[model samples]
Target: MMSKENYEYAKTLYEKWGIDVEEVLGKLRNIPISIHCWQGDDIGGFEVNRQELSGGIDVTGNYPGKATTPEELRSDLEKALSLIPGQHRVNLHAIYAETDGEVVDRDEIEPKHFANWVNWAKEQGLGLDFNPTLFSHEKAEDGLTLSHPNKDIRDFWIRHTIASRKIAEYMGKELGSPTLTNVWIPDGYKDIPSDRLTPRKRLKESLDEVFSVEIDEKYNVDAVESKLFGIGSEAYVVGSHEFYMGYALKNNKLCLLDSGHYHPTEVISNKISSMLLYSDQLALHVSRPVRWDSDHVVILDDELREIGLEIVRNDAIDKVRIGLDFFDASINRVAAWTIGTRNMIKALLYAMLTPNEYLKQLQEEGNFTERLALMEELKTYPFGAIWDHYCDEMGVPVRENWLDEVKEYEETVLSKRK
Candidate 1:
């Protein structure tokens, strides 16, 4: 941990750059990152008679200690949340609703099915967010759901999404916070389709029906997600970025920007500003896209830093909802959550500690030379000392100490899961 004297010295250094070190630390600590629950089980929910994930999504590894039940998943999530720095939220897919070993179809899911989760969140003092599971089912076997040509399939998926919104609202009302239930359909073809426009039309219509019964925005905030392509939907995806961007704009819904949903070269940091301008609110599904939407664990890299900077620099913290979305079963599941969530917090701290006022002024004055030079110089400032101090203040382990807690957890808790 950084010493008190060193922290004060670092504070003075950031003060020179017009940054308030204590204010920055408190703000970063207060901002909550919604930690996705699927990371605990690699998206394999506790559904009985579950089939292998078929519709475009895929998990890469067979690491041990994957949570197989709702209890285990919640336990793992609790362990992960322990090492993270802030009081965070939990994100859930509808497929994760506790069915009590009953065969509940996606379309039949109710708020009662997720009552345990709501209570758990309340007990933990965490907020809840949601997603409708539109993939990996018999109806989705053809690699389509909401946009499927068969009206029956489309209606089924639409009903499921409507029900999901209700469940999200119930959770939110019960927990005294709004739940953001995002809709992302894996509805497209592996090969190039001759009539791509028809499926997109079907998707738009289905979304209209799904949002027709407007739940109170304070209880349930609906967001739409789009993807470039998935494994089976490589040739064309019905819910393209353009499609949902247009939908979100027209319907007055939040647009979800998953960091991994775009091409490798496209970073969401570049899109956050635009998304915030048109939508009443913005939702982010943070992940790392390797060559494609690989769903890799997030790290404290340049793109992550830029994402944090974008949100903070634009003064959109309250307008933007932050969430982590990655499933890495190659390593310890609990550790994966802890590492990714912590890195995300780290990035936000880096952005919070930045002196954006001077940079923005330089740009506005058309002083490109000083702006460029100062940008590079600010990269080497004492960010680590501030981060270390922040972590210490938050009561999370500072430096490499959190990793040891995770390792010890694996040895004591995760290793015996098998």
Candidate 2:
């Protein structure tokens, strides 16, 4: 009763500013964030002959109840999704494929391996996204796969990526929505490389071959993710932002921008508009980086709001694919997913509740003082009430109360896991 009363009062406050609170919530319900499956398992994929987590990727801490199997992972995901409002998609790596204990190598992986996942998504009424895991295998032991000097190594990754696309297509066909198949390779040098051009050349040619076999865009859209540097590739990363940006522009592929992949000073929020101008669509792997690419769980910080503002204000929510890409083993995995995903949704909701057109008009008129003042003042508005109402309306626990549910889950389902 109190929550309902508060929402009514808050709606009146925003109504004075010409912000339709109910309309905003309606739009918010349709925005689907692709929640990452890796968060539940610390990226320890279900490969029969799983190698140690290599590449620049690392998941610190070992909280109890990490999902050890595909069923467990999906169950964890289901719990996380129920707490988060709105429908969402699940992001998967090729490593997560189930092969029935068969030793299916990356290149040999087929759509049948992911049939279970497609079936599961159909039952959940959820969409699926895919990535071809290019690290943590014998082929990528040297921190090189697609850009390896050896043609055979490059060809193997190319075949794996092509197969991944076919699997993504199958997922899209089964689920009735386009599956975003993003390819991110961990190929780079820790020490300064004398010759950077050759590896990049190989990567380009390899990508050319991968995309040469066309699948219907209706079923799947391809994206290439870039990294600035990594644990091994600190000195040189073959798939730098410039490399993939140029490649994506020329080849009609989506350029996936991971928030944690850039220099500490760079923000993915600032790049969304520029990327959209050149390409019809782009994708994002939203992660938090403390100092390096640490992949901490996301929080509703300044940059996050700016990212939401950019997407909402520009009317590019559909054009920019949003997916979470952080995993922390230090805390309960379901709680981590719940926190990060809820924060993302909150950021979007905050953006939508703002009087964006009025602010833009202020900027256009060169009213800097009013613009700054209004922006800062708007921050203190009754945003929490609006958020609480949203959660209630969506059949989710509002605010910090969700934490209690997470604690219950930890005590019951998670604690029982080995």
Candidate 3:
């Protein structure tokens, strides 16, 4: 059947459940998923004095055509964005700063360093997000930053984070969208710490100083990300969930929850509602965790769907800032971004299409059987047809047809990188 025909048929089914298909598509188009730039280069930024990946961050496989320069990374990102539907923001790290081959340390990074990125973003009509590069540096080789025993080390990271927020402020002021500047540091111990309180105390003080600089919230919003455990910090992570949860709640900061940054059994989907109750707004770093925080490409799994459901049902779309965080060098890097981003958007669409109010009524009225049955049946609904129409309307390839373009690009553009 033609796309419009199939869409018309699917629209009827969804409308029966009180879902406005047209409205849903409109809302989905406006929900921008911040696509991370690290995926193109395997977290390897274009630093003049680049360091090896550290702080529990690792990218497997030796994929050819990894973006080696700022221009190449942006070009690869452009290609990926072309294949993906919807206008999205690009999430960047301080390390991705282009300083014209100058050795600009993290602490010294300025908004001018990202002039190219800001200009490109303006041309592409995309928003921008930022993160401070706290790991993979000599000061953080011990896996301690912001909470380092050495005051100088902690001060260095603090300066870097402040600089990052300033850069984000500049992007937001120029782009007319608030830029989320997230801070995730690798600061913990390899073995059992004699005392954890001191490190956390230091971190809290550092954060206070950083936020004291006072960038307007209209331009830049800050978030602090926590981790359960890292390669070197297996025994104890100072910025554990409990620590950051309290800090964020008290300090009025967004506690960024990375899907992969939790224990094996703990799922971030369950935490979204609880976090929203306390924080006016929150952020997410959506990624797939196979066994550990491996940073695999996101798949449309039950958790992803549940996350979408929570966000939609609670009407926290504006309250929650969503960003993708995964890098898989095993597959085509562009394909990785496309797959993960498309899945994230698909998850949101799935949630929007759901009869959430009806489900809530069912649960409230003790209609578990009907609710379960309806949920299961909805899974087999003509969602794929609706998705296809969305792509058709949005002028992007429908279904897996995007893979063909990736293959052609790989052969024509990626293969020639070396």
Model 1 spans with C-alpha error above 4 angstroms: none
lDDT of 3 at 43: 90
Roughly what TM-score does model 2 have, to 2 decimal places?
Answer: 0.99
lDDT of each residue in 226-324, candidate 2, tens digit only:
999999889999999999999999999999999999999999999998988899998999999999999999999999999999999898988988999
Over 1-418, each residue of candidate 1 has an lDDT whose tens digit, in order, gives: 5688878888899898888888887777679899999999988887887878877788889888888888888988998888788899999998887887899999899999999999999999999999999878999898889888899988899999999999999999999999999998888888888998888888888999999988988899989999999998889999999999999999899899999999888989999998877777899999998888888999988999999999999999898999988988889888889889988988888888878888999999999999999989889887888878877887778887888987887788777887
* Worst 10-residue lDDT window, candidate 3: 1-10
**How many clashes show up per model?**
0, 0, 0
**How displaced is residue 73 in candidate 1, in Å?**
1.1
Error of 1 at 349 (Å): 1.2
Candidate 3: lDDT over CA atoms?
Answer: 0.94
Report the error of model 1 at residue 275, Å.
2.2
Alpha-carbon lDDT of model 2: 0.94
Candidate achieving higher lDDT, 1 or 2? 2
Q: Counting only residues 3 or more apart in sequence or on different chains, how many pairs clash (N, Cα, C under 3 Å) in candidate 1?
A: 0
lDDT of 3 by residue, 230-333 (tens): 89999999899999899999989999999999999999999999999999999999999988999899999999999999999999999999999998999999
- TM-score on alpha carbons, each prediction: 0.98, 0.99, 0.99
